[model samples]
Target: MSALAAARAARAAGRVALTVPQLLAARAAKQPEHVAVTQGSGTLDLAAWQRRTQAVAAGLRAAGIRPGDRVALVYGARDWIAYAAAYTGVLAAGAVAVPLSTRNAAAELDFMLRHSGAAAVLHGPDGVVPAVPIPLVWDPAVVAALPDAEPLPGPGPADPAQILYTSGTTGRPKGVTAVHANLTHGCRLDPPLRRLAHSRQFLHAFPIGTNAGQTMLLNALDAHAGMLATARFAAAHFARLIATHQVGSVFVVPAMAIELLHSGALAEHDTSCVRLFGSTAAALPPAIAAGLAAALPQATIVNYYTSTEAAPTQTSMVFHPDRPGALGKATGGGELRILAVDGTPCPPDTVGEVWLRAAGAARSYHDDPDATRQVFRDGWTRMGDVGRLDADGYLYLADRESDVIKSGADKVSTVAVEAALHEHPDIADAAVLGLPDPVLGSVPAAVLVAARPLTLAEMRAFLTSRLAAHEQPSRLAHVTALPRNAGGKVVKHQLRALFDRPDQEGTP
Candidate 1:
């Protein structure tokens, strides 16, 4: 069947029908003795995990959380187990689960809590109040007094279960509303037998509140597998945990791979058990992909191209070496298209924005219809990612549409510059951004990490040979490290701000 037809069938019959609670229950029943979660020192087997979540749900219900109420979860990687329990607990109690990263700025946090109108907040490590006060469940004494109760029953598929906050890469963050049916739609696209049959354990080290972490947790629950956790991703700790848990898989951002390669930590771990290594959130540059494949030769390196608006669109497995940079073809449940600026489909090899229509695609940004309308068209979501698909159907990402550098009259992709710089042996990592220039409108600037001291002359010479004159960096700043978020994507906006400041002017 064609991809479009497959999506239609999935939407009509609900072939991907499965709920958050149901998936967890299936895993708990099928493998009661299997380890379902692991923190630094704590381990919860399937039965225990199920029971904890139910008890947490009961606790939430007893605390007056009702169906449709939004509860905010602020957490990092190590706290995933408890918060994962809370996510299902919130849903099971008929309340909507709102997951937000603890790493977000206080202003962002305040905006999310106030905008989401979250009734309760689950604080992670630091219970300290925000710079600006907001009510939260940070008082251990009060929480300690509450009794463990049974899980509450919730509404059917139509009821809201999860709300993922946007990365706010462009503007203010908006919460993406996902009902039980949405999650069910996501689970159905890939089966446990296909994705998880050979892999019984995965190391989930991403921030707990992000969509990628939620996807991993839900999948683990569906497959009845082990999840080895870490406080955050410490290269040393990650290596040790992989060895200790005999972890079979992991989801990483491209930045993480850069760190792994720089630290030479991969050689420290007994990584033979890692059967699958998947990347998402940002483009996994060809240099990093090649390095990771060489490092983990036995592992299947898959890159899933998706966004908060569209759950899971396209995925490329590293085993398919034919299309090296392809993020993968359109999946069975979505229509993937590369559209020109005018919204017309671009021909093969012509770069354009990626648009996707999928079963589990987010309904809308919670309350902002204007922002929603910008990305959500008649049905499809304009993912704001620029890429091109080969005639054979392989998609190659160039950059986020917003990340495109408008240099004077031309639009240049920063990714092209980064990719060119990554070819430099002395370069450990590179992030390209456009700094405001009175003369050029926006001049390309580069922030890079080097194995040894690197000067602009060398970098310019290297990139000048590989990149077009317009695409070459107008300024190159050698930094101790690239400015990146925990997920491993370069914080281009932050980098732009860093160099644009008056005090740092003319340093490079």
Candidate 2:
């Protein structure tokens, strides 16, 4: 072959589409009639999905949405099929999608819409449209009825694709902008990799609009297996789906994982079909991982650690008996660093701020350059937590910078305390927080979900061998359950309210 011909072939290959919509189009072309996603009783096939998304795109285009326009998607977890079409349609229309969960309150929806300056909103049937000054479209059925037009040219790899709002545990949520390249990172078209090679269908209950849900959407587009999610997550029902469908792969956040183990949801069900039990949206405590492995002895229990800001760029750790609370090393152009206050790298075994960056386009806070400058520096994204790397490069997280307790002169890791607490058979679930103190500035307090009342003295005795003196909880609250966000992270900000009064457990 001539050099000119070879160069021309390379150029042609490079011009192939690289966006999410393009991935969907490829699937539609390759296996048009294959079922792609299922939510409750609804199922959408690749061919039908392509046609529906095209019609929706035409509707958005006719509604005056142009390239780079921010279109908010207010959808519920139950509307996965509709949301999938609308999301792809937004991309097909060359506009950026801003996914807002139906779980979000009126105030949250209003803030995100106004903040993104959304050109329009495509709301699901159950989704509430805040009274923002933007064009509001009806449910997915309305857009699906619109006549399909010739599909618009796919966006470039670097074109802005979506804005995901962060789960605001410490403060107000910020919109993190991800380009097409970033969204499609690790995805392929030529001989597309069959993720979860052992699974025919993968199950999850992640709420729409969360980073975890977005990854599920990507899975539906390119993964070999179809995706299934329930409208509302319940441990019994989640277990039932696995048993009934003989689901080979499953995923959940740590909160759901704990509920499954503690609630006895899997006791009556035959969950032996689960080949992959993946925990994400937060780190899985080693004890919880061990329990899950015992439940599904055949499955490979895996934990993935990632934040909304540092996604596609994450670390995964297969369940290991030796690595306690370790958030695996980076792979495939992913970078993980422990940086000191001055931004210099910390040596192995030294705790510092965790920073991570993926190979694709960097994500930034939408329309907030000042805030973006703080988190997205150079090409790395600060993880907002302090951790250390082992000589082998495994990351061991200590605590979030805000969650660390300063007991007199000692700095305490709530994660370490919580991990120790998890080992106690009496504690069903637990969270550690720093409560204000006149002398120490702040001290560690524990809120627990247990079968019966447990005293601080008992907890201290049990944890004496597991945690340091400064790390032991001085205050305790026995509650029914911990307050969690849609992403399954503990709402520590609200946990403080528990200590205000006493319950079955003695007063703090």
Best-fitting candidate, measured by TM-score?
A: 2
Q: Give candidate 1's whole-model lDDT.
A: 0.72
CA shift of 117, model 1, Å: 0.7
Could you tell me the lDDT of residue 448 within candidate 1? 77
In order, candidate lDDTs are 0.72, 0.85
RMSD of each: 5.0, 3.2
Give one digit per residue, the lDDT tens place, for model 2 in 47-115: 988888888887888888899999999988788998898898898888999999889989999999999
| C-alpha TM-score for every candidate | 0.89, 0.95
Runs in model 2 with CA error above 4 Å? 1-17, 502-508
Any runs in candidate 1 off by more than 4 Å, and if so which? 1-16, 128-151, 186-194, 317-322, 497-508
Evaluate model 1: give its TM-score.
0.89
Instruction: Report the alpha-carbon TM-score of model 2 versus the true structure.
Output: 0.95
lDDT, model 1, position 319: 36
